[model samples]
Target: MKVAVLGLDCATPQLVFDQFKSDLPNLSRLMAEGIYGELESTHPPITVPAWSCMMSSRDPGELGCYGFRNRKDHSYNGYSLANALAVQEPLVWDYLQEQGLRSILLGVPQTYPPRPILGEMVTCFLTPSTQSEYTYPAALKDEIERISGGYILDVENFRTDNKQAILDQIFEMTRRRFRVAKHLIAHHPWDFFMMVEMGVDRIHHGFWKYFDREHPKYEPGNPFENAMREYYQFVDQEIGEILSLLGQDCAVMVVSDHGAKKMVGGICINEWLMKQGYLRLKEAPSKPTPFSKVEIDWDHTLAWGEGGYYGRLFLNVKGREPRGQIEPGDYEKVRDRLIADIQAIEDPAGRGIGSIAMRPEELYRATRGIPPDLIVYFGNLDWRSVGSVGYGAVHTFDNDTGPDDANHAQHGIFILQVPGRTGGHNHDDLRVYDVAPTILDLFGVSISREMQGKIIR
Candidate 1:
């Protein structure tokens, strides 16, 4: 069967069906005709590993990528920021190509420096610039630029103070992305086609405050209050247009890597670690310094956290790190202690923070590179971890990147439809990893033995 997959980053089932069902006719129609549900995302759900997990049908451990920024090795001082090149496993598309089935991939994260495929490829957000060779065939670059004016890898400077400018860029980027996608759909020959629209994620991050009534900084009558809804509607319309391009026999699926939600605030994890005597600095700076810049007193430091949507705590194990402190036999002892302490942390309001801590090995089949001793979700994903020291207080109002209104939620969207099929169903137990195996099953491709997720069928 011909399959067309649309990846909508951060598209949540709650927002799509409960909040804006009426505004999304195309999606609503698909829901009525197909299997729809909440697709559970990866633990500490963020973009980098989430998408990679979906594409590979493997958890972060098997993928060996935990986040956008990864420890380069077992060395504590070295790290490598993830790009498309960082994924070590064979992607689903690679499997399809091996089977002699042609496919076209566009804007899928972890696809930058586009690998050679049986068909066309256009890289996603991780691409450094449009000037780089973003397409697989090399010549497809000129064709994409000619069709969409220029290929938009992603909107730059998403954290700008100018909300309107960010919105405008989102619109332009969405328009270009869909335009290119449409051109490819109509022109390219393929058994499988997939593309991801990052604008949905971008707009949510940029304007969630205006859309979310419960947001602390929300203004009820703001001009951009309907911005997120309007963008989803625009996306729905684009979906309809793409649907019209496909034949009736084709199968269609719409999925998201992870969902989005309002970010309450940030918890300064490093400061908390310091207060708990687990971390130390050479000299306290007058201002906050990044993790890399902070002169860490490793001799005294037992654990340190690197901040993101979730917190990552690394233990200075005696043999693993350069200046290790925690004894090899005490690894589990230190880890369990840190987990207990972090979980017991309370907010300034004298309330439990609702944190969840897990070792990387517990969640994945296998782990590589420098895995965090503990992965933490403060306030159950509402509050991000802030690594900067010298913030003085445990709570902060702004993200390290800038004024981000939302954080990654644990559930994204999953909708599947076969033309002429009726009696649709909804499930809450589906997961991101299930998508790859389901797609493979639909196309008669054998599921990989290494995949942890079961085929939805």
Candidate 2:
């Protein structure tokens, strides 16, 4: 049986399986006629490493890709994009290709700088633009453009107050992406096909406040209140159309990298570190400044952190970093104290927000490639980690990057429908790692010993 994966980035189980269930006929049908449940996301659960982890059945530690940006080495400024180049492990398609099977990949995260595949490929949003070689055969770029009438890599400036423009751009981008997918499925030869629609993620981040009453910034009776529901309905329609193009022999699976939840506020991690004396600056900035641009006093600083949906705290240990402050022998001792202090952090009202800091070695099977000293989830990920300093306080409703209302949740939706199989069975043990092994199992390929997840069956 052939496998087809429909990836909906940031598709929340709460919304898909509960809130908007009736509106999403296609998705509901799949859930009713298949195995469906919440799939646990990777630790930190952002798109880049999460999707990469799902495709390779490898933990972020094994891939050495903790987030969208990773410490290239021990140097302060030595960070690199967690792009396709960072992933050396073979993905599901790679294993299938070895058995002379062809696969189609479209807009899957971390696939930028599209490498040579045995089948056709269209890279993800990380592509510089269509101007770059985003297709495997190079010549396929023109055909893709012609078929989709100028493909869209991503919605530009999605984090904007201009909700209408971003929403329109998102719909158009999704429409074009699915249009291209339909063309490929009908015209191209393939055994396994996977395409990720980014609109779900974009819509949630851009408009969650309007719909979610739980959002701190939420305003009831807003114009865009139904924006997320409408988008999900559209996506379901698109999925229905795509299903029409597939033969009965094909098995379908819908998955997301992670779910979405209302973001209460931002935790200025660097500013908090400064207050804790873990991070020291050469001079106080007159205004908010990015952590990378600020003058850091490495000699006095014990730890500094970079922020996103999660926090990556790096310790400056003697003999490890230039002008390192923490003694090599005291690394774990200092880290333990910091972890305790971080988890003890409270809300403005002095109530605990349930923050926790974890050591890399404790979470992953193996620590690889300059892993952060501690991984943090501020307020259990209800709050984002703001890297900008000079914020004056630990919590801010305003985002350092831009306006965003949602944060990634720990569980994403997963639905699998196999031909000639019983439907409506739900399993709760799904993990991002299981996807790769399940794909290999579907194709009758041997599960590699290096893969960290078990087959879903």
Candidate 1 residue spans exceeding 4 A from truth: none
Q: After superposition, how far is residue 181 of candidate 2 from its true place, in Å?
A: 0.2
Predicted candidate 2, C-alpha RMSD: 0.8
Q: For all the candidates, what are their Cα RMSDs to the real structure?
A: 1.2, 0.8
Query: What are the runs in model 2 whose C-alpha is more than 4 Å off?
Result: none
Please, what are the lDDT tens digits per residue for candidate 1 over residues 372-448? 88899988988989988888878898887787898889999999997667737887799999999999988899998
lDDT of 1: 0.88
Clashing pairs in 1: none
Best by lDDT: 2
Check candidate 2 and list the clashing pairs.
Answer: none
